[model samples]
Target chain A: MLLAIAQPLAWFLGFDSLMEFIAFVIAAAVAYQALKGYRLSKERTLLYLHFSFVLIGAGLLVDGLSSIVVLLSQFHRGFVVLYALGYTINFIAQLIAYGLLVFAYLQQTRNISAQFAATAVVSALFFERNAFAELILIFLLVYITAHTAMNYSVSKATNSMLVFGAFASLTIAHFFFLMFILVPIFFPLAHIAQLLGFLLLLGMLLRVNQPS
Target chain B: MIPGEPGSSTKPVSKYRSQFRIYVDVMQVIQREKNQAKPTRILYGANLSHDRLIKYLEELKSLGVIQESGTEDKVYSLTQKGIEFMNNFKKVESFASAFGFRI
Candidate 1:
């Protein structure tokens, strides 16, 4: 497929990091398209799902750009401060994306009130500097865990493999980050995970389209 | 048959009313298709029966929610009105969610 070819071509062109960023942009486009589709369908659950995807895509795009900059050059001491600030912003964006996803899932399950409260709390907590990152990560872990559980609860849903793949990829990426080995490794792995996730989701979409 | 007229019987008015209602419902479905811009895969995620789906599809095609893409197993997509309706539906959903109503 075009996507499969695009991935390696980006690397060969000395824009490996940029490829990941481009993937984020692609995701954003897909999300936007899906949002429009959901709107046309008048499907509330699908709308929220696409909205969540849009936020996630935006976060990934920001993270991708930051990684690209880091990969291309070393930052000076003063630049390090700027980079740190940027990292904080990126982290906050990611947290917001995760929060939106939680809300989307809750809406799908018809648990609107709980989702609303959770979103507000998560958003508020994201602003607190002390322990903010750790808190957000904790919340993200909880959300992912809960999402997996909910997915399991729905027997008719398809393409769970994609979900598992994404989770596994993220887990490995985070593990590497914790070890402080090479930060660049995380970006590529995350992209791989996202790519797999999207493919899996596409499969699910096709399944839904299948005739009974 | 008209029961009271020359040994003929007729269907009740209620039956006619029900039929009219169904016709209106089908028209709404058709209108939904007419408004979409692209051929969209209409997934009956709610698992409607084949008979019901066929009826809905027929109505939608008539209303232009969908159109025959080609000679192949004609694919269907949404028209502009369909898209607008969908967006409105999403707005309602968003509003409900804002109120913690769970869609």
Candidate 2:
């Protein structure tokens, strides 16, 4: 794993796990909000949103746990495989989660068939400790960002703007992750950007639940 | 259930309104009319046919979300339960709308 060199950066390992944990909590909150909306309105789109965030939360939990395991083992050679496994699982989870989100958007736009095509291609790619997986995630986030951006443009609502900012930040974070291959320093930067993205989502959730 | 787009116009948006949504719509109309909505007002406000309006109004009353008053003209008003439900629904709707999902 390129991030295997994350050893010298070991001091930052615990922080990365903490960040992932925070992201997981925020994702779960978003999922719960979506579920509440689904129950009230019986909207299938809200159900999709619920499932997407559930997957995201699950992925973060797994990644954070594996990071803790690796850190506790003091980078033992036997436990090194856990890092790869965790990354692979996390990557796959985010891929499906984001893919489902894109489907929800496309379904709203009456573009159902495209989801199937994208899914078939994505399943074939699977997970790898390479740029391909990250690229796929970046692609999905970009689509979601564009959709939220269009929504913000139309509604001119603060909540919509927050969502657009969240996805946009996530997309940039993944780009930094992809660049981490060349510049090792990009690792912590990627995690920081990703945390910022999740924080934006938490802000949106809080604002939505505020009394009006 | 088919998920309708937020602002789509290909078909009647009301067709996609679920039972819960209808309930909310009816309650919103009553609230909008200063909590003293007439049958005709709700019929148009909720964009429901006369028959459906009566059916939903009856359901809302049975659920204790609304009450009917007046002997001659007849007026509808939201109960405390209905008011709270609408308040919570507003929050959920805002949350969903943030992500461009219509509920």
Candidate 3:
């Protein structure tokens, strides 16, 4: 799987875990806002957004916690498997999360065929992720970013721009992650980009909640 | 029907306003008038049939979110509970709109 990059990032567990924890918080915040919106409006898209972020936040937490455990155990043999399990779970979570996002976007167009195609693609992605999870994430993020970009182009609102930036950052982060397979240095850069993506989402949430 | 809404297939349908949305629009008009609005102002602002406006107004009154006053000329205002609900609804609207989804 994409777990090959995890071995090198092990050396920087402290920083990596911290970045992930912060990203987790940001993801939860995004999920919370989506939930709040859903409750008020009963919007299915918002509900999808809520669940997707919840999955993302859960994945980050699990992965980060596993890393912390491995670090604390001084890389004991038994604790090491936890790292693999964490990576596997995180990979699967991201797979489903991004799938839901694509589903939400397709829902807007009300295309049943597209929805079925998405489900099939997501199923296909499961096997593909086992080979290169990062690439799959990159692929999904690219589609999401494209949708958000279209949203910004049409709405021309700063909030829409922020959403677009957030997804774009995530797409870049996944690209960096895919590159990490070739160069180890790309690992930290990937985390930085991922965190930037979440931070941009945080910025949007803050602006959205601000008194008008 | 608008996208994202339960059972809705398309976005905006700017011409279509949900009953709930109409309710919010009516309250907003009252709030915009400093918590006291005339029926004509509400009819124009919410773009509702006079019959629909009166029906919705009665509905709001029964729901305890809005109150009626100025019996001679007829005026409407939001109750404290209604004001709080509107405030929360505004947050929801803002959040949904941020993602370019209209609620």
Candidate 4:
């Protein structure tokens, strides 16, 4: 929602390109913070995920600059090539991020085979163009769903319904965004869903870190 | 001098052993502070009681694991040893993660 509002406002003020560049820089900075946190905690897997975020942020920055250049120059072929390259870079970064997340999850659970299956699905979604991205999105949706279900089951057993509900909602919100990629019409909705998911995850982390 | 007098070396042995235990315990608590932490925060994190925590604080002050910040409203933070200890904890945390434990 913020991005949507800011993008047009920046354009109206003739600062759209500059604002986009700033946003990319901010995103990269955030990724850097996450990476530093991981290092402080010695979390290698999370470090990889943060590194992916940095790559993706760089790609977005490049794409935004290229778009601005194209607009100013009346759609130059070079700008188009640059945009495509940026897209490819961003896609690869996202793939690595997802891979590291799944790998971390599997390592936590001691489930090697399950991790492999998840990795394969993620790889297909990343490498496959056309409907493959959509397919991968569906796989992510199911995966998050199943993960939430299992967490909920444990929560029920442990009689921590409230905690379970919070986690389940977060997982659902995350996958909901992934589902949106299947239907491009809902792309904006996907972004909103992601924001909500992040907020919820943040809440959960705070809860975990609370002095008890 | 008498065997149990001030000149005897045995008197310092018991004091040194106790000091050594205090040093080890303080190091363990300091190692847990992977991120920056105030003395009170470290006190709570290690779950030390009031007397025990005070003792540790005093010992750490002498050894320089922590230093007092202000005169009126004093705050304490880690010194070099504390930082190194925390880094060691990070290494242990990474090892645990490899075994499917999210530290």
Clash number by candidate, in order: 28, 0, 0, 0
lDDT tens digits by residue: candidate 1, B29-69: 44455633222324343134567656756665576544546
| Model 4 C-alpha lDDT per residue in residues B35-103, reported as the tens digit of each score | 344557666766667788788788767766666677666566677766664454444343323222233
Candidate No. with top DockQ: 2
DockQ of 4: 0.04
lDDT of each: 0.47, 0.84, 0.81, 0.48
Question: Ten-residue segment with the worst summed lDDT in candidate 4 chain A?
Answer: A1-10
lDDT by residue (tens digit), candidate 3, B46-77:
88999999999998898898999886999999
Q: Which candidate number maximizes lDDT?
A: 2
* i-RMSD per candidate, Å: 17.2, 5.1, 4.8, 17.6
Writing each residue's lDDT as its tens digit, candidate 3 over A47-91 gives 989999999999999999998898788778889889889877887
> How would the candidate models be sorted by TM-score, starting from the highest?
2, 3, 1, 4
lDDT of 1 by residue, A88-204 (tens): 565566566556555655544444566465758475653654344545555664566456545545532334444444444454444433332233344445445545555544444
Which prediction has the highest TM-score against the true structure? Answer: 2
**Any idea how many clashes model 4 has?**
0
Which is superior by TM-score, 1 or 2? 2
Residues A142-204, model 4: lDDT tens digits: 554455456556544222233234334434543543454454334344344434433443343
Q: Can you give the DockQ of every candidate in the order shown?
A: 0.04, 0.46, 0.43, 0.04
Pitting candidate 1 against candidate 3, the one with the higher TM-score is: 3
Name the fnat for model 4: 0.02
Q: Which candidate would rank higher by lDDT, 1 or 3?
A: 3
